[model samples]
Target: MRIAFLLALLAGGVYYTYVAFIDLNFLTRTGRLGPGFFPRSVGVMIVLLTIWALVDALKEGREAATNAGLWRDVAMLMVLAIIYAVALRVFGGFVATVLYLAVTLSVLNRGRPLQNALLSILVPVAVYLLFDRVLNASMPPGLIDILPI
Candidate 1:
């Protein structure tokens, strides 16, 4: 099952990388960064990491699948990611990221509320600053427009 999951991730990453490379330009007309820049980078990283994980899983063989708790954790994280993606549409980048990180950290990093809270707020702020201020790129706006961030 672990191998299967890794294989699926590798396949998805490959497809994402293919689309990023084929459908999007790496640079704008003026030679500045384009829309495809981040996606292409991310897609490449995903493909590489997934391939590494798949290789590791194949080496582990049947022994890795014996841990039901590990599978549960993987499933939970996947579900959280899906929720975060949906939340990005509804709450936009900053608020959705804050909420998603808070909930996800609470579940995955139990007994560390202080760390979780700090990360939940700080990471999103940093990302917002990186994209909106430093990069001069637009963040995804929410449908509801709750925070005015």
Candidate 2:
């Protein structure tokens, strides 16, 4: 499994490197550097690291990779992030942040619902105050503008 995973990673790195190479426009010159510079450099590095991983995995004895129990949590977190981004546009930063943090804390600390709820609300309010008052940075007045205060 480790070998297979490494091989897949290497294959993906190769494909990414190839795509980066093709996307690189050496003709369009920028003020400081060419457009292809960073992509080309990063792509090469990824390929090199992936190759090293593959070699290391191949050298190791074959063993079954244990399935980590946290994959579901990670997948849910990813979905939550997507939803949170959309929520920011619809509910505004404070409201959306409150919702996101509340849900995330609840998800993480299932046994301590009250604690999570308190922290969730408090954290967002603190962040809002810090940014809006101290920094004086303008936050997006998302749909409805529910949090005018």
Candidate 3:
């Protein structure tokens, strides 16, 4: 697990570095700090943190192997993220977010249906109101376009 985590982190660091440096147009006269500055900083931090974690895991002498079901959690989260992404495109941000939250909560909390439902519905609605109504941000128009707010 430690090895896998380290490798993943390293890969992400490299990818982000590329995005921040190679792909970013830093030559523009947009100021001292270009669009890539933050990404590059983040990439550097990721690399450093991964290295630290790797060292810490090695020092523990436990092989970083645990039956804590980390992979399952990671998979569930990934699935939820994908669902949210796709749903945002089709169902719009509000509906997609609610569905994603509900599904994620249901999957994670297998025995709690009522709590999951309430949370899924209420959380998204709250976020929608905060961003769309209060902050004047745009959200996806869901199937029920009547309430674009």
Candidate 4:
């Protein structure tokens, strides 16, 4: 199952990298980094890391059986991912991210409300500044605008 998962990721990364290179320019007219840069870089890294993990898994002996708790955690994350996708469509980028991070962190990183709260707000703000201000790219727009920021 682990090997299959890694293989799937490898295939996705290859396809992503192919599209990044073929459909998008690496540099703009003035030679600044283009929109493809981040996706291309991420795709490449994903490919490399997946390959490395696959190799390691192949070398290791039989996998230990997963417990019920492990399965529960995985299910929780899967549900959370679906919720996050819906939240993205409903609340847009910034607010959805903030909400997702808050809930996810509270659940996963228990007993650290202060840390989770700080991270919930800070990471999205940083990403917003980086994408909106520095990269001049727009975040996903939602159905209704709530926060002006």
TM-score of each: 0.58, 0.62, 0.55, 0.56
lDDT of 4 by residue, 65-88 (tens): 879899999999999999989998
Which lDDT tens digits does candidate 3 get at residues 75-135?
7699779878877877888778878888888888889999999999999889988988899
With a 3 Å backbone cut-off (N, CA, C), the pairs that clash in candidate 2 are: none
Off by over 4 Å in 2: 1-45, 58-67, 140-144
Error of 3 at 19 (Å): 11
By lDDT, is 2 or 3 better? 2
Better of 2 and 4 by TM-score: 2
Best by TM-score: 2
Off by over 4 Å in 3: 1-62, 141-149
lDDT of each: 0.92, 0.82, 0.80, 0.92
Error of 2 at 15 (Å): 5.3
Off by over 4 Å in 1: 1-65
lDDT-superior candidate, 1 or 3: 1
- Clash tally for model 1: 0
Q: How high is the lDDT of residue 81 in model 4?
A: 91
